[model samples]
Target chain A: MKPTARWIPYFLVAPAFAIFTLAILGPIIATFGLSLTDWDGFSTPSFIGLENFVRAFNDKVYTSSYGHAAIYIVATLVLEVLVGLILAGLVSAKRNTTFYRVAFFTPVMLPLVVISVLWSFLLNPDLGILNRILDQVGLESWKHIWLGDQSTALLSISVISGWIFAGFYMAIFYAGFQRIPSTIIESARLDGASELQLLRQIKIPMIKNLTEVAVLLCVTGGIQVFDLVYVLTNGGPYDTTQVPTTYLVRVVFRDQQMGYGSALAVILTLVVVGFGLIYNKLRTKDDSVVEY
Target chain B: MFKGKRLIAGMAVGLLGLAVLTGCSKGDSADKVLRIATPSLGDSELPVWEAAKASYEAAHEGWTVEFIQQDDDLYSTVGLPTLLNGKNSPDAYFEWAGARLDQRVAEGFAADISTDIESSGLKDLFNDGAFAGYDSGGKLSMIPRARDVTNVLWYNVDMFAKNGVTPPKTWDELNTVCAKFKSLKINCFVQGNKDLWTVGNWGGHIISRVAGEALYAETLQKKKPMNGPEFIKGLTVLSDLAKNGYVNESVNSIADNEAASLFFQGKAAFHPIGSWLVGTQQDQAPDFKMDFINLPAITDGAGDQDSIMAVFTGYIVNAKSSKKTEVLDFFKELYSPENAKKIADSGTVLLVKSLAGGTLDPLTAKINALLDGAKVVVAPPDTGFELPVADALNAAQAEVIGGKSTPQAALDAAQEKVAALK
Candidate 1:
C-alpha cells in the first residue's frame, strides 16, 4: 500500500480512540487514583493509601453485597440461560412459531426502568394484583410479600431479570437451532430418536459455542446489574438485595463517600474481570480436550 | 494524497479538542442568571414558584431566573451534591437545617445570608425563633422557608366516626384503636418503609419519647452506643406494631405514595407522614376527610411527651456564587406577601410569621397548633445527623418493623455498623 493510504486507516480510527480515551480510559484511571485518597467530591482529596480498601474488606454490607451478586448470578444462569435453552428447543420443534417467538422476546424490548416499575406494582402486597389473585383463587396460604421479605427479594429480582432476558437468550439459541443441518436431524429422527433425544444429544451439542457465549453473557451481565435492582428494591428489606452496584451507588451518591465508593468500584471491576478470565480459560481447555 | 491525509488529521484533532472543550465548559454566564436548586414541588405550589420567577425577572431587566427541580428523595441525597459540584452550580439551594446544612457550610458551599436577610428586609417576615440552629456562632447560613412536622398520625375522620372510636391520645389507646380497626378488617396504620425513612422518622420520635430526646440525639450523633437498653425499648414500640399486623404487610416493598393511596382509598384507617401530606391530600384525594394528631404519649417516658419530630427546610446562598445579590432579590420576590399567601392557601405551613394565621386550611391550622404546643422539637434521624449513622438507625428500624430481627438484635447490628463508621 502507498504511504498515504496506510495513514488513512489510522486517521479514521483516531476520533473514536480519542473518545474512548476521554470517556472510558480516563474514568478508569481517575477511579484508581481516587481509590487511594479520602475525598468527598467537594474537598481536596488527601492521600489515604489503601485505607479505603482495608475498610471495604472490613465493611460487612459491602462485602456481603458480593454474596448477593453470587446468588443472583446463579439464579440467572438457571432462570435465564437454562430456561431459555428449554424454551428454544420447544419453540424450534413447533411449526409456525413466529407468535411464540415474538411474545417471548417482547419483554427484552421494554426498558429496564419500565419493567422494574411494572413488576414493583404487581408484587405489592396489599393492593397488588398478584396477592389479590392468590386470595381470589383461594391460595392465600401461598401468598407472600414477594419483594419485601429477605428470603424472597433477591430471588424475585432474579426472576424479573430472567423474565426480561430469557427471551433474548432464547432468540440466540433459536437462531443456533436453525443453523443446524436439517439432514442430520431428519436422519436422527429416522433412526427412532425422540424430540427430546434430538435436542439433548444432537441439537445442544451442535450449539456448544452458542451456549458458552450465552452463559458468559449471563454471568457478566448479572454482576453489573443495577437499574432494575435500584428501582425495584434499592437494596432494601435490610440490604437483602444489596448487590455491588447498588451498594456502590449508596456509598458514593447518598453518603458522598467518593473515596471508599471508588475503592468498591475497583474491587467489583476486578471480580468481573477475574470471572471472565476463568470462564475463558475453562472454555479453551474444554475445546482442547474435545479436539484431542 | 498528502493534503487529504493532513485534512483528515486536522479534522480528528478538531473533534478531540471540541469534546474536551464541551466537557469543561460551564453554562452561559453572560445572561445574568440567578439559579436556584430545590426539590420538585407539587402542582399546587409549582405555580407560585413560576410566578415568583416571572416577578423576579420582570423587576430586573436582563435577569433570568432558573430553577433546578429534582425529585424529593434525590434532592435530599445525591442530586444536590452532584449539582453543587458541577461547573454551573446554583446560586442558592434548598437544604434541611441540621447536620446537612452544617455539612454544606463546612464544605464551604453555604454563604452567611444573615446580612442579606437584614438588608433585604426578609428578617421582618419571620419570627426570631425561626432562625434557631440556622446560625453557627451567629453566621446564619440559611433562610427559613417552611417548618415541617415530619411525622404525625393522620387518621380518616369518617372511618373513626363510623367505627365509634376517637383519636388515640396515649400508647395503650393507640394500640386499642389499631386492634379495633383490625377486627373491622381494616388496616390500622399504613406506612411505606421501602425507603426506610418513613418508619425511621416515626420510630425516631418514639425513641425520643422513650429514651429521651438527649439520648436520641447522642446515639444518632455518634456520641453514644445505639444498642442501649432504652433504645431497644424504644424500637420495641415499633416492632410490636409490626408484629400485630397493624401496618400494611407490604410496608417495606411499596413507596410512600402507594401507602398514602391505601389510606386515601379507605383501605387503611391511618397514615403517618409529614405535614406535606395535607397538600398532597388536597391534590390527590380532595374529598377524603382527614385530621392529624401528634404521636400518642408513652407512659413513664423519660422525654417530654409533647416533643414533635420536625425540621426546618430553607435555601442557602452558595458561597461560590457570583450572583448573591441576585439570589437575595429573587428570594425576596419569592417570599413576598402574595406568594406567601398562595403557598399558605395551598396547605403549606410557611415559616413567615405574618402569614401564619387566618390564611391556613383547617388541617394546616391544627398542625400549627401542634407546633405551637410542642414542648420540644426533634429532627428526624436522617436529616438531623450524619448519613451513615442515619442509615444504620433507619435500617435497624426497618429490620425491627419487618420482623426480620428482634429490636435488641437490630439495634445491636446497627450499633455495629455505626461503630465501623468511625
Candidate 2:
C-alpha cells in the first residue's frame, strides 16, 4: 500500500476517535476520579477514597434502585427480546411483510418521552380509557392505578419501555430472518416440518448470535433506564420505580452530592459493562458457531 | 497517488477549520454584552424580565443584555451547575434562596452583594425577612425578589357557597368542610401530590403547626427525631384525608395544574398551594373567583396556627463574571419601582415595600393578608434539611398519602435518616 493509502484509514477514523476521546473517555475518567471524592458539584473535590462506594452499598435507596434495575432488565429481556422474536416470526411468515414491519415498529419511531407521557395518561386509574375499558369488560377487579401503585409501578414502566422498543428489536430479528437462506427452510417444509417447528428447531439456532445481541442490548439499556421512569413516575409513590440514573440525579443535582452521584454512575457503568462481558463470555464459551 | 496526497492534506485543513469554528471561548465580549439567566419562561415574571431587559438596554448605550430562560427543574440542577462550570458564566443567575443558594454561596459561586446593596441603597429596598434565606454570617449573598408563601388554601367562592361550607378556622372545621363536599361526591381538596413537593408542602405546614417552629427547627437541625409525636400528628392529618377519600383517588398521578383545573372546573373545592397560585389563577382560572384562606389551626396544637410555609426566590451575581457592575445595574433596573410594579400588576406578590402599596388583585390581596397574618413563616421541610434528608421526607410524605406506608413507619424511616445525617 502507498503511504497515503495506509494513512487514509487512520485519517478516516481520526474524527470519530477524537470525538470518543473528548466526549466519552474524558467524562468516564473524570467520573472515576470524582467518585473517590466528597465534593458537591460546585466545590473543590476532597478525596474520600472509597467512602462514596461504601455509602452507596449501605444506602437503602441506592441498593433499592439497583433492585428496581434488575427487575427492569428481566422485564426488557422477556418483553422486548422474546416477544420481539415472536413478532418477527409472525411478520417473516406474512405475505405483506412491509406492512407488518411498519405496524410493529411504529412505536419505535415515536420519542420515548412522548411514549412515556402518553402511557402515563392511558394508565391513569380515573380518567384513562384503560381502566374504563376494564370496567366495561367486567374486569374491574384487575384495574390498577398502575403508575401510582408501588407493587406495579416499576413493572408498568418496564412494560411500556418494552412495548416502545419491541419494534426495534423486531426489526433486528426480522433482518436476521431475512439473512437466513430460503432453500433450507423450503426443504424443511417439504419434509413436513411445521412453521413453529422450523422457527423452534432451525431459525432460532441460526439467529442465535442476533438473539444474544438483542439480549445484551436490552440488559445494558435496562441498567441505564432513566427517561421513561423520570417522565412517568419520577420514582414516586415511595421510590418503587427508582433506577440508578434517577437516583444519581437526585444525589448529584438535588442533593448536590456530585462525588456520590459519580460513584453511583460508575457503579452503574460497571454493572452494564460487567453484564455485557459476562454475557459475551457465556455465549462464546461453547466454542462452536452455528453455521447457516 | 498525487491526488490522494492532496485529498489527505485537504481533509487535515478541513478538520483544523472545524476545530477553529467549534472551539470553546468567551464568545461574547464581557464589556459589550451582559448575560442574565432566569427560570422564568412564560411564568408570571417573564414579562417583567422582558420589560427590564428592554429598559436596561435602552438606558445604557453600546451594552446589550441577553436574557436566558431555563426550565425550573433543569435550571435548579443542571443549568446552574453547567453555567458555573463553563468558561463564561452568566453575569447574573436566578436561584431559589435556600439550601440551594447556601450550597452555591459555600462554594463561592455567588459574589457577596452586601456592599453593593448597601452602597446602592438596595439594602433598605427589601423587607428584613427577604434576606433571611440569603444571609450568611451577616452578609447578604443574593438579591431577594419576593416572599412566596406556600400552603395557602385557594377555594372557589361559588363552590364553597354552593356547598354551604364556610372557610374553616380549625382542624375540626376543615374536616367538617371536607365531609360536606364529600357528601356531594366532590373532591374536597384538589391536591397535586404527584409532584410530591406539593404534598410535601402540606406536610411541612402541618408539622410546623403541630410541633411548633422551634421543635421543627430542632428536628431539621437533627436535635429532634422526625418520627416523633409531632410528625405523626401532622402526617395523620394527610393520611386521614386520603383514607376518607377527600383527596382524589389519582392524587399521585395528576400535576398541580391538572388539580387546579379540576377545582376551576368545579370538580373539586379547594387548592392548598403556594402564593404563586394567585398569579396562576389570575392567568388561567380568571373566571373563577378564588377565595384565599390560611390553613386552619390544628386543635390544641403547640405551634402557631397562623404560621405558613413561605420561601424567597431571587437573583445571585456569578462570582466568576467580569461584569459585576453591569449585572448589578441590570438587577437594579429589574427591581426598580416601575418594573416591580409591572411584576405586581401581573398578580405576583412582591417583597419590595414600595410595590406593596399597589392596588393588587383581590386574590393576591387575600394572599398577602394571609402572609401578613403569618406569625412564623417557615421554609418548606425540603429546604430546611439537606437534600438527602429532604428527599427522604418527600418520599415518606408520599408514602403516607399513597397508603404505601403508615405515617409512623414512613416518618420513622425519615427520622432515622435525619438522625444519621447529623
Candidate 3:
C-alpha cells in the first residue's frame, strides 16, 4: 500500500478500538485489580492479596453453581449438536433450500429472554395449562409444580435454554452442509449408502468445522446463561439452578462484596477462555486431518 | 472515483452526526440531579422517593430533581462506593441499619447532620430509641426514619377457630397447634426459603430463650462467634419445624411473595413474617382474617412473647453534594407534620409521636397493639445479617425443605458462611 493508504486502515479502525478499550478492557482491568483487595466496594480496599482467591475456592456456592453448569454443558451441547447434525444431513440436498433454511432457523429469531418468560408462564402450576393438561388426561397425580420443584428447576431451565438455541445450531450445520460439494454426497448415495450411513459416514466428517463451532457456541452460552435463569428461577428452589455469572451477580450486587464477586468473575472468565482455547486447539488438529 | 468520494462524504457525515448526538446527550451543564439509589423497584421507599423529590422540586422550583432507582446492588455496593468517591454523589438518600451507614460515616462520606438537626429543630421530633443509631464522634451523621418490625407470627384466625386450633401461648403449645393444623391438612406455617432468608421462622425464639437477651446483645454488640449451644438450639427448633411438617414443603423452591400469597390465599395456617405483612395485607389481602402475635415462650422463660425483632431505616445526607443545605431543608420539609402524617396514614407505624393509627385495619391494629405492649423487641435472631435476615431466612430454609440439603447441615453451612462475613 502507498503512504496515504497505510494510515487508512488505522483511521478506519481507531474509533472501534477506542470504544472497545473503554467499554470492555477498562472494566476488566478494574475488576482484576479490585479482585486483589478485600473491598466491600465502599471502604479503602484493604490490600488482601490472594485471600479472595483462597475464599472463592472454599465457597460451596461457587462449586455448586459450577457443578450445575457442568451438567448443563454436557446435556444442552450434546442434544443441540446431535440434532443439528441429523437436521443438516436430511436437508443438505438441493431442494427449496430457502424453506428448509428458514424452517430450521426460526427459533433463533426470538430473543432468549422472551422465550424464557413464555416457557415459564406455560409451565406455571396453578394457572398454567401444562399441569391442567396432565390432569385432564386423568393423570392428576402426575401434575407437577415445574419450576418450583428442586428436581425439575435446573432441568427445566436447561431444556428451555436448549430449545431456544438448538435451531440456531441447526442453521449453522445446514450452512456447513451446503458448503460441502454436491458431487461427494451424490457419489456416496449412488454407492447405495443409506441416509443414516451418509450422515454417520460422509456428511459429519465433511462438516467437522461446523460441529466445532456448534460445540464452542454451546459451551460459551452454557457458561454465560444468566438472563433466562435469573428471570425464571432467580437461582432458587434452593440455589440448584445458580450458574457462576448469577452467583457472582448475587455476591457483587446483593451482598456488595465486590472483591469476592470479581474473583468469581475472573475465575469464570478463565474457564470460558480455557474452554475456548482447548476447543480451538482440538479443532485445529481435526482440520489438519483433512488437509486435502 | 466520484462514487468513492460520495461514500467518504457519507461516512464523515455519519461520524459528525454521532458526535453531535453525543454532544446533545451531554445534557444541561447546570442541572443538579440527585440519583436516589434503592434496593428494589417494588418497595415502600419508592413513595418516599416520589414525595421527597416533589417536595424538593417544589421548594427549589429552578433545580431538577431526579430519582435514580438502582437495582438491588446499588444501595450497599455500587451506589455507596460511587457516592463515597466524593466527586459525584447523591444530595440526600436513605439507608438501612448501622453497619452500612457506620462504614460510610467512618469513611467520612456521610454529611454531619448535627448542625442541621439543631438548626431545623429535628432533635425534638426524634424519640429516645431513635437516638440509638445517631452516634459518630458525638455528631449525628444520619437520622432514623422508622422502625421495621420483624419476627411476627401470623396465624390464620379462621383456621384456628374452625379446627379448634387455638393460638399458641408457649413453644410446646405452638408445636401442639402445628400438629392440630397438620391433622386438619393445613401447611401450618408458610415460608419459601429458596432464597435463604425464609429460614427465619417463629422458632428463632430459641435464640432469645436459650441465649437470653443479654447474650444475644453480647453476640451482636460485641461481634462474637455465633456457634454456641443457644444458637444451635434455635436452629434446631427451626429444623424441628421442618421435621414436624410445620414448615410448608413448597418452601425450598418458592419465593417470599409466593409463600406469603400461599398463606393469605389460605394454603397455610401460620406465616412468620415481618410487620410489613400488615401493609401487604392492607394492599393485597384485606379479606384474609389473620392475627400476628409475638413469639411464644420457647423455654418457659420470663421474656414475654411480646418482644419483637426490629430495625430502624434511616435518612442520610450525602457529603459530596453541593446542595447539602437545600437537601436538608427539603428533608425537614418532607418529614414535617404533613408528610410524616402521610407516611403514618400509609399504614407504617412510624416513630412520629401522636399520629393516629388510622382505623388500624382490625388485624393490623391487633398486631400493632401487641407490639406496643412488648416489654422488649429483638431482631429476627440474626444481626448485622449480610443479606437482610428476612430474605436469607427464606432462602436457607427453602433449600432444606426442597430436599436439597438437610436442615441442620444447611443452616450449619449457612451459619459458617454467615460467621465468616466481614
Per residue, candidate 1 scores C-alpha lDDT tens digits across A77-96 of 99999999999999998899
Which residue pairs of candidate 1 clash? none
Superposed on the true interface residues, model 1 gives a C-alpha RMSD in angstroms of 1.6
Task: Write the residue-wise lDDT of candidate 2 on B205-258 in tens digits.
Answer: 887788788887677667777888887888888899888888887778677777
DockQ of each: 0.63, 0.46, 0.39
Q: What is the lDDT of residue A71 in candidate 2?
A: 93
Q: What pairs collide in candidate 2?
A: none
Worst 10 residues of 3 chain A by lDDT: A283-292
Query: B1-422, model 1: which lDDT tens digit per residue?
Result: 66876796799799999999986664457648888999987778889999999988888999888889999877877788789998789999999998888888888999988788788887887865778867755699998887889999999999999989999999999999999999999999999888888999999999999999999999988889999999999999889999999988888888888889888999888899998898789889999999988999999889999899998888899999988778877878878888888888776657776685555677888888887777798989989998889989999999888888999999999999888774
Query: Which numbered prediction scores highest in DockQ against the true structure?
Result: 1
Candidate 2 docking classification: acceptable
- Candidate 2 stretches with Cα past 4 Å from truth are A1-19, A285-292, B1-32, B43-48, B121-134, B319-324, B419-422
What is the lDDT for A237 in model 3?
67
Model 1 segments more than 4 A misplaced: A2-14, A285-292, B1-31
The candidate with the higher TM-score, 1 or 2, is 1
